[model samples]
Target: MTINRRKFLGATVAASAALSAPMALAAGSGKPRVVVIGGGAGGATAARYIAKDSKGEIDVTLIEPTRTYYTCFFSNLYLGGFKEMDELGHSYGGLAAAGVNVIHDWAIGVDRDSKQVTLAGGAKLTYDKLVLSPGIDFVDNAVAGWDVTAQNAMPHAYKGGSQTELLKAQLAAMPEGGVFAMVAPPNPYRCPPGPYERVSMVAHYLKANNPTAKIIVADPKPKFSKMALFQEGWANNYGGMIDWVGEEFGGGNVEVDPNGMTLSIDGEVVSVDVCNVIPAMKAGKIAEIAGVTQGNWAPVNAADMSSKADADVYVLGDASQQGDMPKSGFSANSQAKVCANAIRGALTGSRVFPAKFSNTCWSLIDTDNGVKVGATYEATDEKIAKVDGFISSTGESSEVRKATYLESEGWYSGITADMFG
Candidate 1:
């Protein structure tokens, strides 16, 4: 699963090309408007690109309730104490400085017929094109006997803010040699490598403070992304400290007793000191309110991430049902660029490039030990399809691993800057 240097360099060039500040916008008579909901990787990038690329020809408004965004990606490192809370937090001031109308409010309803969005603040915003990247909401029945109210006890820590701090505190409060159990989510969740990376980081923390602490992962999925590399790292670095049970082993049949802090799998009860129950997820509530979601996620056309249900509306990131792409920030950012290109073209008669997408996922196994998997994609008539892909292999030199980790650090800085400003 190693990436050849030539293939890697070539792909890097093409992906970088898309990130270049867009060309001078074609002059248009009236400014077309784009309203972006949820200022995360997708929404922020779409707003920035449309405004920056359109060069004052497109009025971009962004709706996000939170003034600061804490990224779910790399939050695992924060739990492991490898990163500070401020490192994960980002301010919306940068977006505002970039000429985006940053509104701190919730979007309550969508009237597609009139191309209007109703906000919780009792205001209305009309847009010629709308971008929705509202992230995820948990399914009520995804985990039996566990609901939002029970989340305080067995923290999911999936959203990467206070929940992350809560999980970190729980880890620190665990008595020596105590058990830490997790109920990993099913397929098509944000950051495919995230749960496993969290496990690695937890193991790292426990080894230093609670050497005998045990971790049990009851995962509904039979296998996860980067399984081989993660298993090897576990064996090498934290042998006998972690146990992973897949669906065939009844890991999917789990129920929690929050009062007792018990996790039951296959009718077998296991008392746990700390519990992490990540449930199956669906599109954010706004997507459902907008009537754009089909089943659990919003369906979109591959060409420009436009909603299949409504042409003027586009969905990106974890909320989209686009094919062959994992629910990742990188994927969302890539999709936004494509959507921006199309929107700009429609609004100002600007040049529309072919929709080419790329994503790279990096996971840290230990300090200076990281691994990655990536692919280039194309928008097909039916779905977004993979073009070429590569991954870090099982056996690599320490030099290569360190370099990979450093590469991820560089990417984190660059992508955040791209999204925020």
Candidate 2:
């Protein structure tokens, strides 16, 4: 919970010295300090792996505003009442144990020419190498009449935290037969199948608590990840309780009246008791300020995750533009390993091995049923290309679904261990 300033500063100094010592020795004697921005999946994984693998040779400092992280992967279960908030939250104690310098602060901007990151608290950190994984920032203008303040009434819940809690509360307090509308974002968003999976979980909760309640999905894309499986599951599990409007049906277009909880599409204004509008997203503000992001996402070399705009900097997670990789936490964690290895090699002047990465994203349809999509990728000519993968098959047996559910939980534990523990 609360980090003691003396203890935290002591740990940070120790961690930094540990990381920089090896690089310093390799360079005929000065440690190389690495400052990693963000402490979610990518940043935490990179910091932990670098500190552990380098054996205190590379000084690693991690900057994060929050003391804990709530994973978006399984957040749907929280809405379904299958998991508690604490179950989805993870702390950074493991990183500290691994000798990572965890700085609880927000990065305001980066001085690329000087290799320094400016913190919101007016601290400037110099780094031999910088890794940024600040995650996504929602594009408020993507949806009309929806801003930060307006979102209080129609919660997006896309990024977790208070928004997620607010959405859950609204769902719980809805009238017995109230309508809940979810407007899913367009392509290239975090967790391609997340919105549908969320709808399934909400429907599951409604079927048990408020049987007459209805859930509607206004999808921007006609086809989604695990489309067949989701459609099949929805029909069999909650028939007539869920309605889906694909792109052809004007579900792809969305305009919001946050005050009225209404969505205007195809010249029609439909009112809902509760609305969740997941807008388009881009790299975090830090990335933009650092000149690493091109449009909405940061562009990095696939082989090393080094920013195309700045070689000394690397970007990962939903913030990076890894063409073949989905913006899932699993992908971010995997990319962190690659970034770690690259940083180690860069600091030590060693041969950097070819990078290969893999990701698996699991979505819980309900408490027991789950579906997954996985893939392996490699870098070629500075671009990532998927080599193998499979989306879960439609109508899988209950036993298989149960197995996937267990596997998903195992992955969450394993990933957390890899990143923090």
Candidate 3:
């Protein structure tokens, strides 16, 4: 019997709701307060779960800059013309209805000692436990001749929405036989398979309209996630259109000149009509301001996703350096559930389960042809370690590939509902 993922999600959420034993570990007087920063998968899910499971026992607030969140998970499909921009956008109304105070503002400062968060709008919120899920931000000057200012010209488009649209526009307007160059990010970035999926999407678009258009990828990492699957798809669907240069071939040594619309690899400069420069990334700025991040990412306790810098603070999603789990929306959502249960148990003496996390990243190789990689993880005392994993085989039949794509579509809907409501 085939278990539908959408139905499974509904059942899982129902089980969580029914089984929550909210033991009363009440503080002196009123309800305990929790503050969550960032509203994409991690923060929003954490806030909603805390509020919902607490059964009106705790006050929860979610601080985010945008009223609507755009997921980076399937943003590549937006470029592929398989999904519209609106499909990637979700509102916070559902979260608010679940008793989470959704504040649409940037969290600019985090005070560890005081357990307070200062917003860009000059407001302050105090929390008994603070959850930080601020996503990725590029390392400044990581790529030569590329900076925030140059992003308007070259378009990193990694953040979704406007940037995604900008990249799509560039792809549509490229001249016949024009060169499209991509400087892929290094390891430990958001969604390890994201850049390659993007290349496939762009190639799909160009193949239909401008068949002669070419794509050049200069990748810092020698091997990427799902490398074999992506390469096979590219060869089968977009043969001879993609030129992937790995680290050994000087892909690691890349410099860009946005002013001239050029990309230089291994000292060989090529004038490019359009460029997508994805720079090295680190935990978002707020994580650094919170002083929870060490090096580029924040370290967290495996049990509760609490930051090592301060037990009161928990970091999740792409901003965190948790073991085994890739920085994807699915991973973030899974981590949020574990973190939420822990926080609730701490505040109200609820029955917190052992942290068991899972993630599946689905990528579209061509229209209606998708592949995926996934794993189940358990939290060790040291880190969140992988228990088991699976990947789509290289030579799958067309029917199997199409079914996988459909499964991904089902998962997207189910996860969004789980996070938002």
Candidate 4:
């Protein structure tokens, strides 16, 4: 029906009110009821598209804990003082207006055999097909003394929301010439270049206000996305203001005391003005309970994002293990579109088209300057493979960098619109 933002918001309100309505009245006796878990990039997109493209033949229910979502994609700009939190946060009103049932609740568990989801409120929802995109959960014991309580003392801020705001506050409160420590997690996490991008953003702020402030990146991996480019940029721009320690230099070392505001690396205790510890990650707890996660992430067929463990369930975004595709928001959003199409085809006995996906991640080195990495992929034999893309050229021109920034903004708008509008 060509729904836009205003119409989408109206739909969300109507759908929310209909939640208490009788099932027959809510479904209207024809549409198939599809329940979606989580309302970030993956679930929101799935709900919007399934409701819109199905032409009222499908009733979509979205379960999420929050009404608003703050994206991690452009959060670095917020840290650089170039953007406000409101600019990064988006409301679910648009999705509501799209005829999707938006429920503000956390899903406690899923019954794969019965095709039902149980919420903490004792509400039970049965679905013909279920889509899960619950995102990642941090591994508390990845480092000693690092747990839920420890996270407050050393903000990971990877998932955005309160943790993000806390990290920002800590940065603002740090003394001049103080130390900021960032412990980058191992590979297969939500965002590979996120820690480094944050380093650049914080360095940009420190250079102007606290020039003597230091940023130490203790990375588990020896190399990271666009390592050479980031190194060159830091050396030329920040001039020794940032130091990166790879695995060779004891960067992999980690021990923490949540109460003492101290971290030990290689048995040497170090105290910093601020600390950001990004622990290892796995699929959300629900995914584990549903028997979808193999080790840390759920395994799915690349062609349709169908869970190998359960035929009726689909997993996308950071929770699924899609080879050659980094767990970034752009990738998740793109994958959701593909998965949505696959679900529709499967339900209607239509031919499911082969899947192709794309991703782009932009990181700002400073205001008015940024870098990007992107890739396009095709699925074959249940695995995704990269086709083509570009990493920002080293020492690219000002015009090129600016163009990338604009393109990234456009991508964010377009992807969000595709999911919610």
Candidate 5:
């Protein structure tokens, strides 16, 4: 089923009463508090929705370390020069004005037993419900000769903000005919098509400034999302400027030398001007600290995104191991609405409705050249199952491609407004 703004609010209420869970607040307490960690698409949207819809009946506090959040969604456009850094950065002022208690602090600990969160600033906050949308953290030793300390030399521009800016600057400073290399991540990383899109954007930038510069991608996966479409776009737009090596060709067996500025792919060492190493990812440290993560990710109930380990806790976005959904911003935003509705129902004795979700991921191949893939999902007994889907065609008219790009532009504006406001 598809969900729009109106349908989201007008969900069909169930006849049964809300489930009774132990209230974290004592009787006559001012309000039942909800503590949300991470201020990205999922957490921000959930905090805003619960606060706005509850009408002062519940207290919502959002904990994020960064004061200004740079969205990972459109950050590629910034690297391609289609957008500015300011355009991708959003502030929490709007969420604060909408009644969310936005706290700029790191959530250092989550005590599920006590229903309290400890911050790095030495503050403790109690909550009736906890939401974790902390995104992804890289796995140590996932890539040879790469670690957090080497991120300065061989940067992993996976996360938003400074890392993105660093990569952009590196692209601009490439020597004439310089070699730019990227070590792609394994499966289930955030945004499956992200690294390929970055390569396209990087190629776009180099074609204009340093036409002789080249891009080489070493991917662990045999094939990625929108593989045919991305390959077609690369051939049509980038021509002979890009090369991709998959697992079948020894891309999976690779090592890097950050100090030497070289990558050894299939035992062939090549000196590189800039190396972007995106390693394997897992739920952020706080999720592991909470004791909710089974392995790398936290499993959640499809209906409400509640943690399988703890009903009082919910996990969203890339940190969640929900079935079928790609770890993308659009998916997280959709899941957040479903989670918010359930949280409000359980805490305030409001109406609870069946959960339905939808997501669309748009990628710009080049200037005004766009492609997309999306699906609608419904909650089943096992997981969030896909109902139907659509994807951009390999061969399409320029007019159609441009229209798709425009549609993506509209979506970016709409979703950001929905999230921050």
Candidate 6:
């Protein structure tokens, strides 16, 4: 089954209400323990909700290597010079203060049978339940002649933080009239409209700094999210600066030489100053290590996001193969709340509300010009099914577009606050 791609408010209400309830500890263990790996949108939110809602009844440990988590959601804005790197970075201190044991360390192995996680620092953590929300990792050889080793040269910047900064720096340093190329990913990748939004942002940047620069996109898919809207925005905002090659035009048949800095499309090679290669993605390594993954993703029951392989294991966000929800930060945060409630119920006998989800993806095309596509969802036996949806149109008024961008700013503020504190 194909998942529908898209975010809204419900978080502030849910967070405040959950804090009001007091849950009792499970009878068997001193405290029902939940160990979450990868402290991003899904893991951080899940850890915070379980700890906050459980009210000392459950022990929550979040194991993450990075102390400052950079959000992938708005990193494109950083590329466009609209946001700073610090704006995208959030410290884990909030989770630590919320009675969550926030450990800055890598979770190297998951012994599902033993109910233990081994850390790179040579420590072991035992848990009654394990939540994996490790976002995404690129598939091996998904893009020919490119790998993690070539990242410094080609720079996918798909993940956040340093990579994003590197990409922006490369963009800024490009020679006048130099080429900027992007090898777009296949379907089921993170953020359906991300690449196009990025192109728009890059164009915005170059138009101001290096007006003669050219932007090229080789997309494997025949089309993409918010296609008409994005195309229209490109034509209006960055005329004659962007060229998009879809699958029929051999965009799918491509290769990159990182060392030589050349991108070859349909056997036609051209040297580019900067190339952003977003490869196919899959669930992070920890899920596969836990033996909860079926193939590239971990399959979960739609109701509670419990692993199909292990009852005690749950997967959230981009790592999950639950039906009909796109791989997105907003989707992950939504899934985290549902997973948190279900886990709280199973461990502490707290009320487990029916699982419902929602997501909104807001993309900035130019200054004060934002467009979005979003939907609400409900959990079913089959998957997280889409209920209703909405999108910004092609020819919206300037006031409408500006309002949409401002709305996105508000969402970013709300969601981050919801996740961190």
Q: Whole-model lDDT, candidate 5?
A: 0.89
* Clash pairs detected, candidate 1: none
lDDT of 2 by residue, 1-421 (tens): 1112343344434533544443333564667899999888899989987887687788899999888888777788899988898988888888988889898999998999999999999999999999999988888688777776778888889886778889999999999899999888888898888999899989998999999999888887879998888888998889999989889989877788987778887668888999998888889999999998888889989998889999999999899997799999888887887888789878876445578887887888876898888888999775888999878888789998888887777777666666777
* lDDT sort, best first: 6, 3, 1, 5, 2, 4
lDDT of 3: 0.91
Q: In model 4, where do residues sit more than 4 Å from their true spots?
A: 1-30
Query: What is the C-alpha lDDT profile of model 3 across 72-149, one tens digit per residue?
Result: 888999898999999999999999999999998888888888888999899989999999999999998889889989
List the pairs of residues colliding in candidate 4.
8-97, 11-96, 11-97, 12-96, 12-97
In order, candidate lDDTs are 0.89, 0.84, 0.91, 0.81, 0.89, 0.91
Give one digit per residue, the lDDT tens place, for model 6 in 1-421: 1121112345456554964465666798478889999898999999998888887788999999998999999999999999999999999888889999999999999998899999999999999999999989999999889999999999999999999999999999999999999999998989999999999999999999999999999999999999999999999999999999999999999999998999999999999999999999999999998999888999999999999999999999999999888899989998999999999999988778889898889999999999999898998998889999889999999998888898888888878877888
lDDT minimum window of 10 residues, candidate 4: 18-27
lDDT of 4 at 204: 88
Taking all chains together, the TM-score of candidate 2 against the true structure is 0.93
Q: What's each prediction's TM-score?
A: 0.94, 0.93, 0.98, 0.92, 0.94, 0.97
Best by TM-score: 3
Question: Residue 157 of model 4: what lDDT?
Answer: 90
Please name the candidate that would achieve the greatest lDDT relative to the true structure: 6
lDDT of 1 at 134: 98
Model 4 clash number: 5
Runs in model 6 deviating more than 4 A are: 1-11, 14-22
| RMSD values, in order shown | 3.0, 6.1, 1.3, 5.8, 3.7, 3.1
Give the winner by lDDT: 3 or 5: 3
lDDT of 5 by residue, 1-421 (tens): 2333443333312211132222233356588899999999999999988888787678999999999999999899999999999999999999999899999999999888899999999999999999999999999999999999999898898889999999899989999999999999999899988888888899999999999999999999999999999999999988999999999999998999999999999899999999999999999999999999998999999999999999999999999988999999999998998999899888877777799898888899999998889999999878989999999999999998888888788777777778898
Clashes of 6: 3
* Cα misplacement distance, residue 193 of candidate 2 (Å): 0.9
The deviation in Å at residue 359 for candidate 4 is 0.7
lDDT of 4 by residue, 311-336 (tens): 88989899998799999887887788
